[model samples]
Target: MLTGYQVAVIGGDARQLEIIRRLNEWDATVYLAGFDQLKEGFTEAIDLDFDSDQVERLDAIILPVAGTDDQGRVDGIFTNRLLHLTESWLKRTPSHCQIYTGISNDYFTQLTSHINRNLIPLMDRDDVAIFNSIPTVEGTIMMVIQHTDFTIHGSKVVVLGLGRVGTGLARTFAQLGAHVSVGVRSSASAARVYEMGLTPLDMNNLAEEMPECDIILNTVPAPVVQAAVIKQLPSHAVIIDLASKPGGTDFRYAEKRGIKAMLAPGLPGIVAPKTAGRIIADVISRLLKNSNREVDGS
Candidate 1:
């Protein structure tokens, strides 16, 4: 149990509520920031202002799974406010304290540099992400079923990118009897895709292969599914872009072509918030415990 370590959980959505609950259960001195919209009764955790003075007392700070954007603004989903994390505020965090976030960007990187402390992106952890991918793929499949007319059993599935999420998506679709084709840049990844019993193709030739596809899942963050690519897709095809905000698909082009395109980020929180929250709590708990052990040893 986290008997002595103090934790500050900043802005997040319903998923974060579970994290706070778990932390409180573990006996951590929990502080809740930007939780004004939440109903009362977290007596174990005090609500604090999101400023340097408040941040300095914590052993660790947990930001939302999306972390702050490029402008140093975190999404206050529960409160509907934007919390800014300036460089000076980051510098106020104790040297022994650690920052935990899901993803990183230029703003986060700059903030960390100013603080001269490491920021752990939990989403970058292989164990965390692989487990998280299950929920993400399930949610994506649910979206596909909800949006498309064709059954996945016989559909032509095109997955762009062969990263963790992309690989999980391809496998899930393939298992559902879809004819899965993965787009990859490297020959090694292409060969790995082939070894997995799925068709592997170079992303450079996506246009030629687009017309036959029934479902296009783009994991690439850039504009991979642009106007040209969308134009080549069948009118009935559905495009699911699982990348971060503003996803990978060209929404305007897809809409103009009568092809449905959706940016479905944060599938875990949407499909299974409780389970996702528990997973994050478990990982954070382990990390915190390890940190305490090291401190005690020193």
Candidate 2:
């Protein structure tokens, strides 16, 4: 029940609060860093300052979903004070201490290499990503329904990239009676798309097929939908780019062409914060349990 472990939860938004609540229910001693902005009255959590000296005492460190930015700044919405995660902080963590984050960035990678410590990305876990896909798909569908005049039934939906999110989106759209098409890079993925009863097209052929789509959902991280692709699409087509910042679609080109384009990242947190937090807490608690088992075994 995480009774003996000291967990330090660093800054995050509403989702973080849910995690804290769940941790408290599990009877974990949680030290909150940079949570001054959090409303008072969390019974089992202690809000502490961001100091390197505290790093040595923790059994585990939990960062936000985005981990850290390129500049090594962790997400801390509660405090105005900037907590920079430096290599020194990593070095100060005890040898057995584990680090957890949602996603890794350049700064995190650098720290991992420099400190020789294992950094587990909760978002990268297969079970977590699979569970998170439900909210993501539901949120994407909600956005499409909200923005479009036409119903998903009989709408032409094109999903770019066959990753977890894209696959879930395609299935959901198709199940809702939309004519779904999936754009993929490999022939194998194309075959899989066809086997799933969705039309499969090469990403390179997006321009040729763009005109048929009423909704284009892009999961690709790069700029796949440029001016050329946007020009081929019908004016009524809505583009949803689900990639991270600087999303896959060319925003300027879409604006110029009058195509409605949206970049929707972190759909789970937006649409279902409590559910998302629960998913994270479940996975993290399992991880902590397994870690404790290993310690006992050794």
Error of 1 at 90 (Å): 2.3
- Residues 6-123, candidate 1, lDDT per residue (tens digit)? 8988888777988999999999999887788887558888876664376777788888999988888888667777888788777777777888898889878777867787788999
Candidate 2 lDDT over residue span 1-298, tens digit each: 7776778888776677888988898888898877887666587787655564666777788888878888878867778876787787668877777788888887787777678777898877888988998999999989998989999999988899998898999999999999998999899999999999989988886777664779999999888888878887888889999988879999998999899999998889889989988899888888888884346742
Q: Candidate 2, overall lDDT?
A: 0.84
RMSD in Å for candidate 2, one decimal? Answer: 1.8
- Could you tell me the lDDT of residue 130 within candidate 1? 85
Clashes of 1: 0
- The best candidate by lDDT is 1
Residue-level error in angstroms, candidate 1, position 151: 1.2
